[model samples]
Each structure stands twice: as structure tokens, then as C-alpha cells.
Target: MADKNIADKNIKVTIMPLGIEVKATRGEKLINVAYGQGLDVNALCGGKGTCGKCRARVVKGGISEYTENEKKLLSEEEMQQGYVLLCQQEATGDLTIELDGLNNGQKEFVPDKGAYAENITGNDPIVTKTFHQLTFPTVNDQISDLNRIIGDVPGKVALDLRLLSRVPVILRDGEYRVTSAIFNDTIIALEAGNTTSQLYGIAFDIGTTSVAGYLVDLHSCKVLKTAFAANKQRVHGADVISRINYTIENPNGLSEMKELVINTLDEIISKLLAGSGIPPEHIYIITLVGNTVMSHLLLGVNPLGIAFSPFVPVFAESITAAVDFLGLKTLLPAARFILLPNIAGYVGSDTVGVMLATKIYELSGNWLAVDIGTNGEVVLAAENRLLTCSTAAGPAFEGASISQGMRAEPGAIYKVAINDDVDIAVVGDQEPRGICGSGLVDAVSELVRLGVVRKNGRINSPKDCPMELPEKVRNRIKTRGNGLNTFVLVEGKNEVAITQKDISELQLAKGAIRAGVEILLDEAGIAELDGILLAGAFGSHLRPESLKGIGMLPDIDVTRIRPVGNAAGSGAIMALQSKEQLQIACDLPKRTEHIELSLHKKFQRQFVRGMSF
Candidate 1:
């Protein structure tokens, strides 16, 4: 049975039996309306009607009529039961209808429409501590305003314009009772009447390739919301060196890049604030953690020196900047921006963020933390010595370097496991769409195990393969324009293929990481590692077994491998929460020794040797 009502305003309409209800806009197509609400009535080509898994029943209103496409996807028995294609049917009126059992599968945790602002970690450095009061202006005690404030305020307490603007109002409102937000002894924001209830902070891990942020409540040191997006500045260049070169080639290019990242951050912050139902003024501080180039870019400093000779950063110390400098206008105009210390030109804030979050500085045992991104930052600790370096691993892992490659999005193949027989268990359990970074590692490893690919990463002949290659795999070679060695992972529609060129890209990426580790160990005079801590989203999802099989990682005790999720974000949060920790972060650059692996001739030899499958 079905019921219908024509509603004038946007309303929530509950579908009978399914118990699903969503607020939809006026005149929205019913099928489209359902899809928008995440009703997973399957559409094989995602509403393109190619495989047609979205058949449903319109038991009441449209029972007498049927569309032509509906008949093609439904059987006579199904039609009698009042079946229809969910995609083809339109919601002419607010209606209730029965749902099929097949479409009623259990739901997974889909991210909500709003931003998340809870359960965050690593956000203490940027938030300010409050412990100061304002004085009233009296006619008899006519001490000049500047001198009166300066005399009472502690040493090195700097005040920015945003805080200066609100001083008079705050003084009058609080009647001299105020708690000032202090960053590194500098006044950032002032709260009247000893108000200290709602202190909020935002921690940002601005990578060269991507941006991840966490909104935190400073009072509880809890991360309230988290957001991640591709770095918009990447459209200009892929690597740090490339970006630096762009900056050097075009004088304003650096400023433009900085502006793009700031704008992107501002947008994300706005969305995050909206999601958390918090106002921008409530956020008292922002802590930014990124690579050296990224840190320099955020500060609008020229990174040309880093791109070229000597490779020196303008400053490696942690800096507390006014939010206005970065165009974060919504924050307490005087909101503080605390930047993490950088070890070197290449090893930037990201490494420091990892160090802070992992507590590598406090640990006594030999440890290695590898933050894998386009620029693979590695930190190795042994006894009293700490060494760090940046390896130019490029963007292969994120699927940027390869042709026809993409991120681990909805249809992307995120995993592949093949036995000796060469059978592939693809991710998403459907026709292969495109290969992701993790899937590439698995595919290469499985190809080696099945002898489909040779030890040197060459594609074997059809006869040499343990099992016959699929039409998809064979087509890669057949369709190659220059008679190059290419292998397709999927065929025809939504096809995914890998060419020799793609393999080379992966090879180069792996080589850089492997060489970096080896060089770091060689310099440390350490033969082996007790353990390897892999950090970052990419590193966390990477299968160690697959990585070892493909020779990306040394074949060691697998038990020693650990993935620490979002180490940079974790570190940023840690810095935001502790003033002591913030002080330690400020001194880390001075204490660290940055080793340039590219300058070493031995690094080239090691990288070449690591190219083997």
C-alpha cells in the first residue's frame, strides 16, 4: 500500500517499512532524493543504468503504470508484486511504499553531513593560558595607558592590534577583571569577568600534498572535529622542490601559493566551525604543523633558498603569529598561530609534529618514525643522537604520478590479494575501477608471487603466467600505443590498467624511501632497527605483508612494524595542549641535525639497487 501528499515546504517524509526519512528540497526527483539521502538502492554504474541493481516496488500510487526500463530490470513475478527501479521512479508526491529485503542491508558508519568536533588528540600548543587582569582608568592615577599596562604585564608580553582594539571595551565591561589569552607570554585575546569556560583551538597538519585539521576544545584538550582535503596549492606543483622552483621562477608565485593554502584552510575552518555549531570568535588559537616549505609558505616567506644552494630556512624556531597574518579574520583578530619547529629546509613542521605526538623526544630506546607523504620525512633516534632527513618519494602513493591513477575513492580498488594461482580479490567486490596506492602494492606483490611479473618488475609472457591473464590484463599490452609493456587491471567500462611507466613511477617512489632509510641507518652506524613506526593515512592503510612481498620494506620480523595514524595531527594536538611541550617543540630544530641524503653519492647507488621488485 502507498499514500501520497503534495507538500509545499521542504519536509521530512518517512518511507514505510524502510523506516528511512530525510528532509528533501521542493520538486526534487524522488529517485534522486533517495540517493541524496544515502539510500543505497544499488545502481551498478551509479545511476547510469548500465547494470541496473536499483529495482524497487511502488506498491501504491504508480502500481497501474510501469516505465519501459523498469520492465527490463524486473521479472513478471516481481512486477505483479509492484516492483519498480528506484532510480527510474520519481517522487511526484510525499509517499510511503514497501521496500524489498535486498535493499535493506545493514548500514555502515557513514560520516554525518556536518563536521565532527569530538575525540581529537594532539592540540595543546597553540591554545593560550589565561592569568592576567586589566586595570581601571582613574583620573587621580593618570598613569599613561601604555605605561600602566606595560608596567603590570610580565616581561616580553607583546600585544597585537586585534587585542588592542578590544582593550577599552573589555576594560569597561569587566571593570578591570579580565583573563588574557597569552601565547609564549604574548597577549592574543582577552576575556572579561574572569571568563574561561569556552576556550577552543584548531590544529592543522598542512602537508605539501594534503591538509588535515582537528578542532579541539581547549578546556578538555579533546579534539571535537576533524577534516581532511587535498591541498589546493598542489595544482601549481606536485613536490616541494617544484613549488620552491615555481616561487623562484615567479616572485609573486610564493605569495599566491601561500594565499591559496590560507584560503583553503579558512574554508575548512569555516566548515568545521559550522559543523561543530561553534562561532569563529570562540576559537582562541590555531596551531599549524607542516613541512618546511609549507611552514614558510603559510608565513608568506620566500622558500627559494630552500629550493636551491645552501638550503637554509629563514627560521627553524616555533613562531606564534597573529591569525590576521594568515587571513583567518573570523578568529579573535588577535588569535594566535603557533608553528611547529622545522629541522631543515626539507624536514619541516610535519617532522616536528610527529616528534611531539609520538613523544620520540622523551623515549630512551632506539626508534624510527616515518611520516610517508609526497616528501617522506624520517626521524631516527639512537641513544643520545637524533637524526632526521626528508626523502623525495614523490606522489606515487597518492596516485598522482601514474597515468589513469586516482585516490582511494569510492570505486577505486584499495586492496588486491592473489595467491599462487593469480586470483585477484578486488576491493569493493565489483568490477575493478582504478588502482589505488595500497592496491598497487598488493598487485605488484601478488604478481611477483604468481610469476606474472618478473623479479625486475617486468610483465611475463602469457605462457609464463601461472594462470591465463584476463582480457583486462592482456589489453594493457595490446592497446599500448608505442608497443610499451602495459597491463590492464580491469577491462572495458571502468577499466584500470598499469603500464611499464606506472611501475617505474612506483619503483622510483619505493627507491627513495628505501634509500632514505638505508642512508639514515648507515649514517647512524646502526645495522638494524628494533621497530619501524609508520605514520600518516597512507602508511596506516598500507599492508605490511604486501609491502614486504614487493621489497618496499626489508624482510624483517613483521612484529616490529606499527602504524600510528595521523602522527602529524597527533603531534599538533599534543603541542596545542601543553605549554611545556610547546617550549620543547620550539627548541627541537636547534637540537636536531638534518642530513641531506641527496648530497650523498652513495644515496644514488642505494636508490638504484632498491629498484628491484
Candidate 2:
């Protein structure tokens, strides 16, 4: 009776940008309204109001008073500035929201697109062209121009209405000699002369922090050009949960985030086309590899379901759809986007790509694969007994959470070494703007060595720090501004410092990851793994020694640790080039297992244990 009464009170709300006018229950929270409308809101806490990411500006209607959670998460200035927490605000009446973009910073990871060094087994391009000369049709031999062209081709092929429009002139202009570009079983394009040589595909890895893409020549299976850019969605929120909450909180949030990613891909795609001197029409296929949440967001599917208890995804199998379906069809109208399959809720397709790139599934002995990021995924396998889990590592590793942290771009410090004195290496050898993930690891490792920080992540008081240092180094330590004992890494205008909370963030990140690794190893009944296969752009930049110092990695032979740069992207590349490779990706989920960390009887104990060094 109560459910029926609530259903009777449904109201309609209008959303702009996406221009959605949908029926929502009266007084329903904005996140649920947005979620029901298929909008991706930045609700990291699943509308619990713990994360404070799902915020929207109420432009048309008045909202209820702010809650205590809002006061804690948002600044008073921001609240007075008109920003309202979406989770706390209810749809009392019709409302309009203005979704803001995150200011652009950091470049995307673009792998070098040179000659194709990896061996490709087969040439089975979905789009290929065939050239044929037809006999001139007189009245006696007259057949329709469509049939005439179809007869000249080797096998049965249908002519698309779009391409059919060009058939008349194409035959006459080429004097019955023409090249027909066959996409799948249909002729998509007709050329006056032999233009069958141009064939390409693009493989992409969409990460939480960045997106990387590679353009490959289908004929030769060689990388022709590559392009990347920072994911424009970062401005909305830094992590997947944040982006999810945004959709839940804002009416048009989902569509807005989807557009941002597509635009980012379009930008990178344009550059690749320009650099390769290939027409967009020539690229026949694209394979996108990302976590399940990211894949859901790209498909404009609501991921809030996966954000809460009993986490589940809308699609677990591989998806192949025409480019037109994604709104960027103009760039590669003939292309079909292939999304690799996900292993489970949090362990996504990117992990499948990791498996393929590292060949860990087929490998013997104990093997541990960790792709550390905002959400860290760890896979452990002994022979065929595979186990995997995703730990909420937070955004510390990506130069997030820390006050002065930034992406590994120009002017960002990438490395550090300390003995008698401190030494640093900056990306592009420019002035130090901020420290990135690699440098953070380096600093933490060196600080531990120099006794500036204890195993509990407590910054030493000047007296607690046993290592005697120069006056300059000693002067860098101070405490102020909601601060704990802080170590100033840089001075001047671009002042950078690491505080007690900064170390705490790192501790949480590393602990979650390490605990996940331990759980997997314990399940497999192995004391230690044979080696560590680190994937992801961040993993590539991390030093084994630094990771070990932070207790993020297991104590293993230093020589055993290997960085497989963008293995997910490589897996996408392999999928684009070979059907067998794509099949291997699809088959991975069946053989693998996903372990729920929170549900584990020992998770709490391990988590508490992991919080320390």
C-alpha cells in the first residue's frame, strides 16, 4: 500500500544539456533521479554522502538545508557559493543543473606508434577491399549497375544504400574497373581506382586518470601513429566512484561525462589521422579496454548498481557495436568498437588485456599481476588456479589526495634519491611544479631511509628524526595549515610539501594493495609469488625498490619485478589484429575467479594490518 502510494506521487523533472524530461518520484534524491535517467553522477559513496563528490548547483528550485556531512566535506565558501550536495538534496520541484568540467591538466599516455614489432598470426581484417573489372553492359548483357558490380566481386556481398548512391558514377568514371571496400559482408565504400591499400584500426585503453590510443595499419598489423590526452572527465571527479556519484547527483551528468570521453577520443583520433596521413574512413575497427565502471560509463549505462552492495555490471560479455551508436560515428563511420570482456564486477576488461599481454594465464608456477591505480587490481595464479580482487587503493598513486601532487607531466618531479643530500629528477628536466606517483614513492622510500618518517607513517619531530642533515634540509621541516609534521620538498611560488596526512594517504593506498596481494597468495596457499607483473602507466613508472619500501609490493627478487607498460593497451592492439587474440580475451573470464575482499572473513584483520607499513 505504501509503495503504491509513493508511486502515485511521481513527478516530472527536466534536465538540460542532455535535455531529459523524465518522471521521478516526488522528493526523490537527485542522485536517484539522475541514476534512473541513466545519467552518470559523481556519487563515490553510493549516495551515503560520505564522499562529498556528488554536488550540483540548483538553478531553478530551492533545496532543503545542508546536512552536517555537507558542512564537513564542502567549504563554507563553496556552500555559500550555491553548490549543494546532490545526495542530500531532494527533487522537491522541477530543477535545472549546470554541470561543470574539470580544468584540463596533464597529457594522455600515447605509446610510440612505430613499426609493428610483435608478430601477428593471421590477417583477418573485418574490412577489406577487392578490385574487379566488369565487362561493359550493352542492352543484351544489361544488368542493373548494382548487380553488375556485385557479379564482378568474388563472393556474395550486399551493397549498402549509402554506398549504392555512388555506384552509378563509380563504374562509368573508372570504366567498369573499381575497388569495393567491404566491411563485414557489405560494401561500405566504392572507389574509382584501386585504393584497397589503406586499412587501419585504433586500440585504446581508457584509464581513470588518462586515456591512451594507438593507430595501427590493418594490412601490415603495424602501428602507424599514436595519440593520447588527459581524460576530460577528470574535472568532474578523480576516481570512478566520484564520476559515478556525479551521474547520480546531476540530471545530465551521465551524458556530460560520456561526451567528455568521446570528445577526448575524437581529439586523439583526429591527431592520429593527421599524423598517419590516413582518412578516418580507412580505420575499420577500434578496441577499447577499461575497467567495468569505465566501460559502463562509456556505454552511458548506470554504474550506481555496482557502487553499492551486491555490486553488479550491466554487461559482462564483450560488446561490439557500430561507431554510429557512440555519436562519434563521423570520425570512423565504418568502424565497429569492440569492448573486451570483464572478469567480474571490479576486475574489468583491462585486466583481461593485462592477462593477454603478460600471458599470465598460460604461465606455470605462481604469478602475481598488479595494476595499481585509483582502484588497484591484483591477480594471483598458480598454474590454472587463478584468483583476483580489486582494492580501493584511492587516488594517492596518481598524484591525487596529496595537496601538491600532480600528474607526471613537464615540470613534475619524477624521481628522487637521498644519501648525504637530496637529489631529484624532473620530467622534461623543467622546474619542479609538483611531485608525481613515481617521485612520491621515491620520497617516501628516501624519508624512511633518512628516519624522517616512521613505519607507522608518522612524520618525525626534528628530535625524532635521527639522521643529521644540513641546515637547509632541516629547515624544510615545519608544521602549519591543518598540518602535521611536514617536509617541504620544494620552495618558492610552486611550493610543494608532504604532510602527515600525505603519508597516511600513501599508507592507505599501499596497504589496500598489499593486503589484496596477501589475500590472493593465502588463498592460493602460496607463501610467495614467483614474480610481479606490474601493468598500467603508473606501474610502469614505479620503482621496485620504492614500492617495496612503502610495503606496497611483496619482498621478492628485484630482478623478478617486470613493468609491462600499458599491457591493457597492448591487449587491445592484439585484439584488433587477431581473431584468436580476441577469443583468448573472451575465454579469460570463464577460467578466472573474482574474490570479494570485504566479504572475506579475514578482510577486516588484513585491512587493519595493512594500514601500517
Candidate 3:
């Protein structure tokens, strides 16, 4: 309590280890203040204090007294150590806090679209430019400019009212030689000279955490350049529900969120053109796919409908719009945007893209395709019919909720094994910073195999060790005076360890995923038949065996567990290049039945069962 004057009462909160500082007001939540300053704290539940995602250790100065939320979320020892949920704690005065490594700004490694580029070949593009030598208007054959341009176009072509005004000058400038991009039976552009071969389409995967954009030449179906960036709308929240709450609560928040994503897309466009030397006008088409909320946000639609019970989406069908509507600059005046159709209230166009890329909808035998992110989508298909469900796994796997968790960056521990001795494989062979999702899976699996953790996911103390373990293993399992147990994976300057609370977090996450899969399988009326395709950024590095051991995935043949990298993006790429592939994406959502796992009777039972290792 330094001062009563507003001018003199600036609370400076310093977050250490990163050496970041932010200005705060007294009585303001630490999470809200940090989030308002664009700091990345784990507010996956939108500062509601239910997720227990954002915890800070107050190194100096005073913080508000802990509430029941903090008491239930944080350990008593942690409370004694000045650790409190940033969402639950408020600023009392200037404070300095030490923070654990939270964000994983790792460069994702998704394969090029050429992996299945051939599958979508031979189909005509929805938009194609053809060079035609139009007969110039003569006195005897005086036809309107629009008619003259469409005479040699083979079939009937509708011209935009805006393009009709400039048709005369464009044709004269080209000396009766002009190229027109045909969208179905409509002529959208009238460009002078032959530029038919320079067509490009952008395939975008709008993930909750990040966005992946691919600039592809539709003529060759070749991916020219790729761009990746964190999603700008994450400031509102980590998941769609949080974003929905943001939109419903704040005025003009919808427009702001929409602009944020659009700006990101524009930046990606700028980057793609800058890196590949592709002319802006040459990029004419855009195919965007994401969850229902992201798709709605891109179109400036309020997504609160999908955030509550009896979830309903504004639009699940495919949509086509003018590129300029998104406030983006393009080289071609005829550029258009195509949003891939969404599946359900929760299952969105990204899943449609995944199905198109993997051809899972057309495949026979029992097949399960899962796209993991903040929200996990699982599809169980058996050729004729498919059952799909969305699992709220939170952001734990992406390294948000855990204390020593991080993204798969250079210094991250990506692989771990505890045999006679503990072995760690870092991402870039650098010093261990923190464990990533894959590392967590491997560590948990190894611990189970070594009998260090029980089947019910209990970490046994050294005195209660069931088997004689290596001294290194025994030393790592420590019980603090507060009676809380934790296992240290790496003991160094930046110590990396997993607490008992972390295990519970992981159990909740993996349990949700496992239960969702079981429900879909039960609905599909299949036990063990065919394969499981893990599709997304996290799946590429995940070990199927580890996923099985931790009960995140079913115990299936490792060979059947195929990691189809960025299938959603690849499907968008396919849709970008071929009208037939685009149709496949459009027709998918109607046939699949979306299940609500929370409303299911056996969900709680399965969730509890799956929580055990």
C-alpha cells in the first residue's frame, strides 16, 4: 500500500527468468494484467481459475490473500512458498515473480503437400484463367463489352458488374488479347495479357495455437513456400470456448478477434510472397480450414452458439466469398476465398480437410482418424457411416498447464527413458530446458515400465519402492517436507521435474482423449479392426507405444498407428488445387454423426476407467 494517488500507484510486476515486466493496477488480477500486456500466461480457461494453468511464485512484494480456488488448485506447500494461481491472485503492490518456462515457440515440421498431390490431380480448378483472342467490336457486330469477352469462352459466363465497367479498356490494352479467370460459369476477372499459368492458391490451417500457410501453384499442384505463425487471437483465450466468452462479454471484441486473424493471414501472405518471390496478383485462391469457432471468427461471426449446451454452429456448409472482403491485398482483382465446410458444432472444416487428405471417408475397414490440438477431434469411419466426437483435452499436451512443460523447441526434452539409468533426448542437443508433450509421453511410459509408477498412476516413494531401482531413479523421487511427491527428470540450473499435480493434469487430459475414442468406437460397433491415423503438429513426434502405455491411445499395432502429418492442411491443399477434392470436403460433414461425449451415459465411467494407466 504505497500511495492513494492514481499517478503514484503504478504496480510494476516483474516476471523473472524471462526478465519481463508489466505495469499493473492494484486489485487487478495478475493474469488479466499480464494478459492485457500481451504476456503469454496459461489462461486456457480464460482466467476462470478452473484450469489451474497459470501459477506464479511471488519472489518479492505483496499479493492478495489466497482464495478457495487457489487453495483447491495449488498445494498448501506451494501456497507457503508464495505460489498462487495468477487468475485467482490480485496485485496488492509492486511484485517480482519467478516463472517457469511455459510457451513452446518451436518450429513445427509438417511435410510438404506433394505427399498426396497426385491424389487430387486431373481435376479442373474451380477458378481457371484462359487466354482468348476476342473479336474486336465492329459496326456490324456491335456487341456489349461483356458479351464480346465471353464469346469465345466456350460456354455461358457471367461477368461481375464491377469488371464490366473496365472490360472495354482491358481488351483494347491487350490488343484484343486478354485472360479471364472463370469461376464455374462466372467470369470474375478481366486481366490484360496471358497470365494463365501463374495461378496460386493458399491453403491455411488455422489452429488454436498457430496457423500454417502454404502457398501452392495450382497449375503444378506444387507447394512453393510455407509460413507458420502463432495465432493472434490467442490473446483472448487458448480454446474456442474462451474466445466465445470473449466475444459475448466485450463490445467489438468479435471485430477485433476477426481482424487479429486476418492480420495474421495478411502477414503470412506477405511472408509467402516475400520468401518465394511470387507476385501478389498471381495468388488468386484461398482455402482456409480450422475449428468451427476459428472458421466463424474468420468470417466475423459470433461463435457463442457453439460454446454452450445444445451447441449449434452458424454455418457448417462450404462458403465462397470475395478475397477483398477479408481486407487483404492481392495481385489479381478476381481473387476469391473458399472456406472448407465444417462437420459439426465442434467438428470443423479442419477435420473435413483431414478426411480429404487421408481419404478416410472413402476407405474400408475400421479406421480412426484423430486431429489433436487444444480440442481433440476423433473420427471413427467404416466406409458407409462415421461417428465423430470432440474431446476437451485442454492445452496440457502443448506444454501450457504443466510447471516444467514447454514446446518442442531446441532446448526441449523430446524423448526420455528411465531404464537402469535415465536417458534424455533433447530437440536440438542443447541443455534440457523442459519436457515437451512427446517427452511427457515417453517419460510416463518408461516410468510405468520401470515400476516406478503404479498402474493407477501413483509415484511410489523411495521407502515404498516395490522393486530395487537404480540410485539415480531413487534419488530423483523426492518427498518434500510438505508431503508432496515429485520426480525430477533433470536436475540442473533450470531444474525440470514433474509434480503429483502434474500427473493428475496429464491423467485428465489423456483420460478425456481415451474416453472419447472409446465412445466413438462403441458407436461405430467395432472393437479391433483397422488403423489409427494421428494427424496434427503434435502427432508427428508422438510415440504410439507411449500413447498406448499412458492410455491416451488404444493398444493397437504400432504399424497401424500412422502419423499423417498435417492432413488437414494437406486436404486444404488438395481442395485448393482440385474442384473434385473440394467437393469431397464439402460432402463429408453431412454424413458424419457428431456425438457429444459429455452427454453420453458411459462417458464418466470410461473417463474414470481411462484415468488409470
Report lDDT (CA) for all predictions. Answer: 0.69, 0.77, 0.80
- The local lDDT score (0 to 100) that residue 483 gets in candidate 2 is 56
Candidate 3 Cα lDDT to native: 0.80
lDDT per residue as tens, model 2, 307-350: 98788888899998777778784464545788999987798999
- Per-residue lDDT over 9-90 for candidate 3, one digit per residue giving the tens place of the 0 to 100 score: 5788887765678888788887777666556665656677866757778899987878888888888898899988888888
User: Native-vs-model 2 lDDT?
Assistant: 0.77
lDDT of 2 at 413: 80
Determine which window of 10 residues in candidate 2 has minimal summed lDDT: 100-109
TM-score of each: 0.74, 0.79, 0.87
Which parts of model 3 have CA positions greater than 4 angstroms off?
A: 1-122, 329-334
TM-score, model 1 to reference? 0.74
Top TM-score prediction, candidate number = 3
- List residue ranges in candidate 1 displaced over 4 A: 1-161, 420-432, 466-485
RMSD value for candidate 1 = 11.4
- Can you list the residue pairs that collide in candidate 3? 104-407, 280-331, 281-331, 281-332
**Clashing residue pair totals per candidate (backbone < 3 A):** 21, 16, 4
